[model samples]
Target: MHIETQLAQHRVTGLRAQADAHRLSTEAKPPVELRTRVGWTLVELGLRLASAPGPAPAVA
Candidate 1:
């Protein structure tokens, strides 16, 4: 019984490690600075769109 319990605990620990590995693999995304810079620049440019364009989209 003790050995079975230990095996079960080991299996649970191994599963948790596997889950952590997968979570990190999926969630360790690259920084958004590069994308944000272009978006921010566009937003800055669009701020004066009323006088610059025929029809400009709303910016977030």
Candidate 2:
């Protein structure tokens, strides 16, 4: 749980850095930053799936 919170904070920090860098430049975002963004999005998606409700019981 502590590690999870740290990871979430790191994701927030990374995204803010990317946004600030982009705002300062005309060129498109770097590939690494793009990949990082995708990775974080996937991580959040997986976490949501992990915490979701289980399936209903089957009929007899």
Candidate 3:
């Protein structure tokens, strides 16, 4: 039973290492094109501007 637990733990550790490596490899290179990046940036800017509060009314 102890040996089985150790083996299972080792397997889980290896799998976690493999997943971390895969995540790091994928993150190392972004898949977005320049056009896509620019588009998303514009979309975000538009959203921010749209949601911004307008100027206050003048007090007479």
Candidate 4:
């Protein structure tokens, strides 16, 4: 299955997937290394989500 379809089926997306965008961030950590990785993952996911089209409109 395609990624877009997979995302839809799994119900995983940046839009509804995360209740709070803030949740995606890495809380202040002793070292910056952890933050860097979290940031990268967020960015990667954001790009994929952005590229995907929104769900189809509900029929009347």
TM-score: which candidate is best? Answer: 3
The predictions' CA RMSDs to the true structure, in order, are 10.3, 14.6, 4.2, 20.2
Per-candidate Cα lDDT values, in order, are: 0.88, 0.90, 0.97, 0.77
> What's each prediction's clash count?
0, 0, 0, 0
| TM-score for each of the candidates | 0.46, 0.41, 0.54, 0.37
Prediction 3 global C-alpha lDDT = 0.97
Report the lDDT tens digits of candidate 3 across residue range 1-60. Answer: 699999999999999999999999999987889999999999999999999999999999
Which digits, one per residue and each the tens of the lDDT, describe model 4 over residues 1-60?
899898886775665566455555545435569889999999999999999999999999
Total backbone clashes of candidate 2, pairs 3 or more residues apart or in separate chains = 0
The sequence of per-residue lDDT tens digits that candidate 2 reaches over residues 1-60 is 699999999999999999989787746645568888899999999999999999999999
Predictions ranked by TM-score, top down? 3, 1, 2, 4
Error of 3 at 17 (Å): 5.2
Clash-forming residue pairs, model 2:
none
Over 4 Å off, model 4: 1-32, 56-60
Clashing pairs in 3: none
RMSD of 2: 14.6
Residue 34, model 3: lDDT of 94
Give, for candidate 1, the lowest lDDT window spanning 10 residues: 48-57
